[model samples]
Target: MKPAAFDYHAPATANEAVALLADLGDEAKIIAGGQSLVPMLALRLAVFDHLVDLRRLDELGGIEARGDSVWIGAGTTHAAVGRSAEIRRDIPLLHRATPLIGHFQIRNRGTLGGAIAHADAAGEYPVAALTLDARMHTLSPRGTRDIAAADYFTGMWSTAMEPDELLTGVTFPVWRGRTGFAIEEFARRAGDFAMAGATVAVRLDADSRIEQVALGLFGLAPTPLRATTTESEVLGRPAADIDPAEVGRSATAALNAVPADIHGSAEFRRRIGAVMVARAWARAVEEASND
Candidate 1:
């Protein structure tokens, strides 16, 4: 089915786009790459009276280093992100998660900001962002605001962003010390949305003690989640003393809202989620140990 009749808008600048949204009110929606929105629109799952296109806004499309973090413009495509050497070197988790987003054709047209804003629990980028504690930047008539990744995702396909706000970019902190990152997910087929997934980041001290770690779980909850309980359990423990399987169990044990559908029941998803956490934890520790 085709999308219902709606007015198309191409704004030359972000300020203009937000202005249009502010004027259009709740009836308007922002369109970046349209990889996700197009499907929703075609299916009549989402209807917008006006679409403020950001395609012409060159300001929202670039990658740059900012102090100890990398800032990726919201309009940057997934393929562009995967091709970026800086992203691969500085933020390996994000780079690694890029190829798992549907197919090459989808990635070619999918934008980083769109993925995060769409806020799918199974999306690789959302889980990666949560794992890295990335910061989201937004613009509105009121001015610019920064939202932490932990607080950014509020519910299913919902965010803290106001209707008039435009997501401008994301800032991912660069880990400087001996660090390792890995993401693991279980999907029925290649390029399918994961049933459950985990993204792990670990920084180890010289003596093989865990200095810092993050376990971000996706496809197991309504929103991308951080396994804080499990992280706290192994925070200062020696790498050899911690068991990945135990950590996985602890991570999923605290989850209360794992989704259940035809693909899998909540209990089944938790089981898969635990395994993903365990696998990701093992790989991440191995890399950190080698470093």
Candidate 2:
């Protein structure tokens, strides 16, 4: 199937792209790498009267270190991100999650901003951003603003961004000290979206106590979710004393609105989610202990 007929505008600057979006209103959609949007368009899942392309906006593509955090432009391709040494060293969670996103071909054309803005429940970037407390920066006719990852995702394939707001970049905070990160998921096949997945980040004290820990779950809810209940339950506890299996169960226990589809039933997803959380938690803790 082919996409519906639409007018295309490739803007040379960020300001110009947003201006086009504002002028075109809801009828216009922003196209970056178009890895996700193109498929939706081809299937007629999404239709737009106009598309404001940002491919020519050089300002929206780059990776920079900003003191304690790393800022990645929305237009930066996933392949670029996976190849970035700074990201690999500073934000290992995101670095590790990159390869799990579809395949090399998808990553070659998929932009960071497109993945986060698309806000798919099963997307690796969204779960990694949520786990790392990344901040999303946006530009609009009204001005600029930043949204916390926790508050950014609103529902399945939905976000808090307004119609005219263009996501310019994202800043992921770097975890210092004895920190470790791991991500685990269950997919039916290679390069397929996971049935259930978990990303875990942990920081341990010198004495092997859990100083801070975050568990982000994907493919088990309407939106990517943080296992705050399980996090609070295990925080400050001795690393050796906590049971990863129990933490996994607690992570998925209170989850509501777990999706049920041909992939799997909600209960089955919860079971798979628990196993993922456990595996991720164990690996993260082991890495942190050795750090």
**What would the per-residue lDDT of candidate 2 be over residues 1-291, giving only the tens digit for each residue?**
999999999988888888998899999999988989999999999999999988899898999999999999999999999999999999999999999999999999999999999999999999999999999999998999999999999998999999999999999999999999999999999789888999999999989999999999999998999999899999999999999999999999999999999879999999999999999999999999999
Highest lDDT model number: 2
Residue 56 of model 2 has an lDDT of 91
- RMSD (Cα, Å) for all candidates, in order, is 0.7, 0.6
Clashing pairs in 2: none
lDDT of 2 at 141: 89
- Candidate 2 TM-score versus the reference: 0.99
| C-alpha RMSD of candidate 2 | 0.6
Task: Residues 191-259, candidate 1: write the lDDT tens digits.
Answer: 999999999999999888999999999999889999998889999899989999998999999898888
For every model shown, the clashing-pair count is 0, 0
lDDT for each of the candidates? 0.95, 0.95
